[model samples]
Target: SLSLSLYRAAMKGPGLFSDIGKKGRDLLEKDYNYDQKLTVSTRTASGLGLTTNAVKKGGLYVGDITTQFKYGETTIDVKVDTESKVTSTVTRAELFPCTKAMTTFKNSDLNYGKLEVQYFHDHASVTGAVTLKQPPNVDISGTLGSHGIVFGAEAGFDSVLGTFTKYNAGLSLKKSQTIVSLQLVDKGDMLRASYVHHLDGKQTSAAVGEITRK
Candidate 1:
């Protein structure tokens, strides 16, 4: 629900999550706290250079789970300003989607490659081609139990919707009660791999591990 004043103001501009059905909002709710315990461990050295030591590392986190308890599918009018080394612009109108989950979410994306900038030089002409990336059908996996262990395999498609398409597969395992996952990708001419790990339960991060020719 929104305050009357808020509703009136939002109606004046463009925004997302302005109007959605009640059923859609109710299905998405967030509930999370935490449980705790204390454990101890020790190590002893063997005959050669044996040593005994103990170690521990633990803590708690709040809002670890992200659920849709605060918004719904809607739109409003607003203004936005964005800046980057690549481009800059002030946006006035936009359509947004507010859903329980995004079609694809990237926690972190790092691109380190040749920067395409304008340079004047005595050189031959160059032709350019526009590109789109189509993700490939992939295998997905998860784990369960105390260790989060190795859950199961889930498969998905990696089509950038008909662009630079690639095939991929992934699995998740629990390491020390923490969930870590990895994805392997393959293009027709090249192969790429990535690893993902969950610090808590929802913060998914990915890293591009290796890319090699086929």
Candidate 2:
């Protein structure tokens, strides 16, 4: 379930800063799901969407349901798991020209609430997030790029401990049909390099490779 957790965490923001070198990363990392979870999703013209996922565990099917609604620049999502715990998220985009904001609440725990914001420019992007609790954790990330190159870094801080919890950096180059990226992740405990090349103009076919060291 680590992959699913990571995917949910990554979905918290608008993805401006985190998307800096995402092409190569996606090419190298996505689509390796071995969990064998069965998922079905549908959307209606009324801006309502529903998704259900079921996975076999302990010879039984465990599942979750997620409902989403979109109206204008705002989106709302609500999810319920087999245990009947509810989580809700609201996202607003373009609140101030290229800015996005989101808030999430889990179950009935006030401490489980969180807020996130992101802003994007032609050559730069930034994101910030904080937990709505005493002694909360805070996160910040930024990226700068122009003319087919980008550099980005992200950090997390524990307000109560007054220490950094995480830090990572990445760089990427994108040409007409190829993308190369290098990332230092896991609080700088791992290094990775990835390359992706499109085989044709439509980008329907491609080659991808990656190397990592811990």
Candidate 3:
């Protein structure tokens, strides 16, 4: 997933540079006499707020090939002569990222979006990330009821990154600023429920419920 995100970022930014890279790759393949190999594997598990039995292994190999590319005012020949594979099984708590910089952008008419990069704690490790996207706010909804008192319908924008979410709007039902409950509903052809809660810190509660399906 991270690799995919980086792929997208590269495509969106520095379009000319990316095109040059592709052309260079084509040129290299056309003239260079070399082959390469790469492989990676991983497994992970987390429990008790701690990581357990996490591991990763990867390696790379390439034959001799003098490659050069344009980088500012300098030329470089990056050749992977040899490589080795190693495995690491460390706890998640010990695996910390070296988040060096994060550039946040304020709302503006020009639409210069937000960007962030996080380095790794490992001296030889690095990972770059950026969320360069913003979707438009488009809402379309409709509701209908036959009763004379029927007057329930609602729609709104929502986003959840850390926890859970719910959406429920009805005329007869008493709306609330904070309402938490487990519900089982089968109305028309849909089955859904919306619960609400504002749980403050350092608080405990005891509640139980059963789940059923049709």
lDDT, model 1: 0.25
Q: Which pairs, if any, clash in model 2?
A: none
lDDT of each: 0.25, 0.76, 0.26
lDDT score of residue 20 within candidate 2: 55
Tens-digit lDDT track for model 3 on 1-214? Answer: 0111111121221121112112223432444433333333332232112112212223543333223333332222233222322221111111223112222223222353423232222111122333334532212222232221122222223232332122333322112323222222233233223333324433232222222345
By lDDT, who's the top model here? 2
Ranking by lDDT: 2, 3, 1
Cα lDDT over the full model 3: 0.26
The 10-residue segment with the lowest total lDDT in model 1: 13-22
lDDT, candidate 2, residue 211?
85
Candidate 2 lDDT by residue in tens digits, 68-134: 9999988999999998888887777655554555666776564455566655566777777777666
Give model 1's TM-score versus the native structure.
0.22
RMSD after CA superposition, every candidate = 22.6, 5.4, 22.1
Per-residue lDDT over 8-58 for candidate 1, one digit per residue giving the tens place of the 0 to 100 score: 112211111111111122222222213442323333342111122222225
Angstrom error at residue 18, model 1: 27
